[model samples]
Target: MSGSEALDQGPLRVLSFGCRLNTSESVAMRDLARRGGHAEALLVNTCAVTAEAERQARKAIRRAARDNPGTPILVTGCAAQLRPAEWAALPGVSRVIGNADKLTPEAWNAAAPPAPVSDVMAARQAAAHLVTEFAGRARAFLQVQQGCDHRCTFCVIPFGRGPSRSVPLGAVVEQARAAVAAGYREVVLTGVDIASFGPDLPGRPSLGQAVRRLLALVPELPRLRLSSLDPAAIDEELWRLLAEEPRLMPHLHLSLQHGDDLMLKRMKRRHSRAGALAAAARARTLRPGIALGADLIAGFPTETEAHFAAMLDFVTEAGLHFLHVFPYSERPGTPAARMPQLPVPLRRERAARLRAAGTAAAEHFYQTRLEQARQGQKETVLMEAPDRGHTEHFAPLRLVRGEARHGAVLQARVLGADARGLLAEVA
Candidate 1:
């Protein structure tokens, strides 16, 4: 699970966990729940990325039930999608909605809901739900794609998310335009496997095509950002956008789960270490100041110390500015779980080492930029909070004090660095 939060009103509260896609979908679900007059209920949007994630969701459900004894608790999202009955059987859960039903308003307000889930693989298209607002986000996320076509050995997401599908280009443009019209300075294109977008579309358009079209069609949008991307899937058009589209933010978070070639192959990943390096290099060459980030897994099944060492080196080689290090946790049914397993403690230890390296890399990047800021290099930041924002390169910044407005872009001469982030005052 990526994160969790609670939103409470008179009748409806939502507890959401997982990715930005989930966050966007939760906003849609929130609207549906509010409008359906189920606002008094508690909805838990769960994640099933790891066994720990499911455990956390279950724990959260129990706690929510204990805390709000009178409130009805509804469960949904990836964890629920995979095991609807399992969640339904939980003590506090009054009802369980599958991934397919989570966004459907009728399901939330049904007189009596049917069997909560259907054959997910049989569902072909992504539901095109345009969320008008993000309750507590600086930018609006537009989900242009959903589901995954590839089945990696270590992942259960494909089963939970269903087959790869794209929201039609027109719908994407309209959503982006609406977000810009609604006064959002930034729009992030999000999805289950965003880089794998458009294969199921009419023209077999690439992710690049959708992004190019979105920018062209919604010229008023000040900034466009992307979610996690597969290294092998970035096309020529995406490269062109990286080079030329100033509005396209200069940061790419890659879905490079590991660096060892054997581990990557065993994991059924398409890109190799060399390919990942090449992709990062190409992105950097195209967008000179672009920041690169990636998701890295430590201690995958049968991963040796040498293998992990290679991964640690790859982080520096790729010049990664951000890192999401996941400790390998065995999900019961995945192919990796059936393979030779690493001890849980060992996996966590490796993860900590990787995270420390990632932290050092991030700090180095911040310190370098802090020096540049001290040298009078002006940075423009979009204020997400009254005192917090991030740079275009996706570096976090904390305002020391200033006339700040949420969602407004500000030019600031970063004064110094701190544990919170870059300490800055308006230029």
Candidate 2:
């Protein structure tokens, strides 16, 4: 699980869980709650990606009630959206807000009644919320799309997020502009299925088109990044952007659930094993030395030992530098949940193996980076903290000398390498 955090310095505290999109929404919700006079409330933005995620949210809710006494706890997010009554019955939860109304002004009004959960599947249009601040974050997560249209057999997110929707290009530019104006050196475009962006809008512009326009319109923005992308859905324009746009960071994280062809088909993933490999190859050809990452599920229903072995080898074959490995967690109401199940211990064991492979891959990639650094190659580092930041390829870097300020972008030369990241000095 991605770490959860309390946003803002106001009386209204927000605990955001799960994805960057939730974090972005939490920032907006904090402002809305303050403006609507809900200062004494604690908002819990929950995630339903895994059963463990939901368990953590419930644990947090109980802890918040025990520690804070009478502070009203408001629960919302994919978890709460999927199971409103379950969350509402928890101690100290005064309201259970759904995803559809969580950002609306009325939902946070102190005088407003508890709003009924709207049908997320009926959400036709996604409106852009101009979020200029990210509290403690150096990079801003600018949401350019929302919801999902695909129904992967093992996933339940589409039900919670609804149909695919795109925030208009003009509004996206405005938000990017606002984020850049607010001192963010990097802006990550986030959404549920961002590659599916723009088909719902006028002229049906692709994600590539929107990104190209965003870069063109905001020349002041130093670096732009993207959240997880669908390998099957990447368009020609986006491939060209990777080849040509220097401002676009050279890191691509693909939503590749599994590497085995049969496993991918069972997971209802659109891209096959060969197709995924081709995508990785294309990315490398377009952007030399590009770092590739993927979301891989370790164990799925009916996954044989051979299938697991193939997936483990695929990581090395694809040259994946980063991996988000999830042990198969059965979300009820999903197709995979009904299939023959694997033992929990076995699933976890496979996850560990996948992670081990990923670590080895990362170490190899870092060694190459270190070699480049030793050769006096320079890298642009975005300082997320005083002593640490990340390179353009999204590798963690540490400043061994030369003072660095948070949110400052500087060119640096690598001095050394370690297990965690690179050691560098401002150049």
Candidate 3:
């Protein structure tokens, strides 16, 4: 049969991009597509976080079409939702499904779906799509919430994701249990605004409460981690988890967009420079050796050198070991886009400088850990590969072959360091 004919009766092959939340949703799309009898179609689950992400998606669509020949291609996710007509006009695309409609089973069927997705801003809740396994990985992502309530001027996700909504607490626990039963050693609770979890649910349980309940109910879950955290939203329950929960991994990736007060205000962020430092210090105090990571944007509208300098200083002051840096990209319709803009080249240059700082901080943190290793400290490592695993502090370690089996949680003694990761021997 022709590839298109086969697609009419077969399962879907999903190409996922972007955040862990997108990864989680892709699994559901595949399952729904299979049940809907379009198992043979190819779905491009796109990301629109940056212009580059969108560019890659468009490139991949053409590549999928070229490689698959007669196979039908379908597009969805944030990118498609944000620019439905743009995706629909692409050469190989047979249908362009919106973020909200993609989860419904009927939308996955071979029949052409409805045009231009309903206004995503009108969306009240994120659809609940349960996934049993993570397809190919040892770790799985469980989505507890969807969308964002915050409207940071530089961000486009809130519009793409809609107003904040959360999955019920009981539903979250059930999903965690399923993941454990499926043999996943680690499960990450992911969302566009994970910190805002429970506000829409009854009693408005905080993210901390959700984590506490999940860990308590799923005792067998080996490791639980969070995808991203907003600095202003760190609650007491989360602090308690850091202090007492051994199963909770000791890594936090913070959403601290800018370090300068004026830039922060312009970005519409809730936390201040001092507040971020305090939160990081508190986390470390509660869990000694915890590694802190952060997301930083290098250039924004009206950003001066002094503003950039404050951000550069904030990295070291806050002692951030890992950083995700982004050069501000102007998305259409955002307030920041209309502000006095920075030179595109300058934005990229600043981003590069921030990344360099991040590298130095990472190297310094690694050296400090190695010092502890020399002093005979050991870390609990979760083996992702036969020769490598990540420590509880989220540092990668290379193991001596045959020293520890894959998937084994071993007390690995760090012997020394290399450019990529720490070299270790099973203790």
Give all TM-scores, in the order shown: 0.97, 0.98, 0.93
Of 1 and 3, the candidate ranking higher by lDDT: 1
Better of 1 and 2 by lDDT: 2
Instruction: Sort by lDDT, best first.
Output: 2, 1, 3
Q: Which is the winner by TM-score between candidate 2 and candidate 3?
A: 2
User: What TM-score should be assigned to candidate 2?
Assistant: 0.98
Candidate 2: the clashing residue pairs are none
If ranked by TM-score, best first, what sequence of candidates would result? Answer: 2, 1, 3
Q: What are the candidates' C-alpha RMSDs?
A: 1.5, 1.2, 4.2
lDDT of 3 at 319: 84
Please name the candidate that would achieve the greatest lDDT relative to the true structure: 2
Q: For candidate 2, lDDT tens digit of each residue in 245-362?
A: 9999999999998999999999999999999999999999999999999999987999999999999889988889999999999998999999998999999999999999888888
Write candidate 3's Cα lDDT for 195-291 as tens digits. 9888878899999998999898999999988988998998899999989999999999999988999999999999999999999999999999889
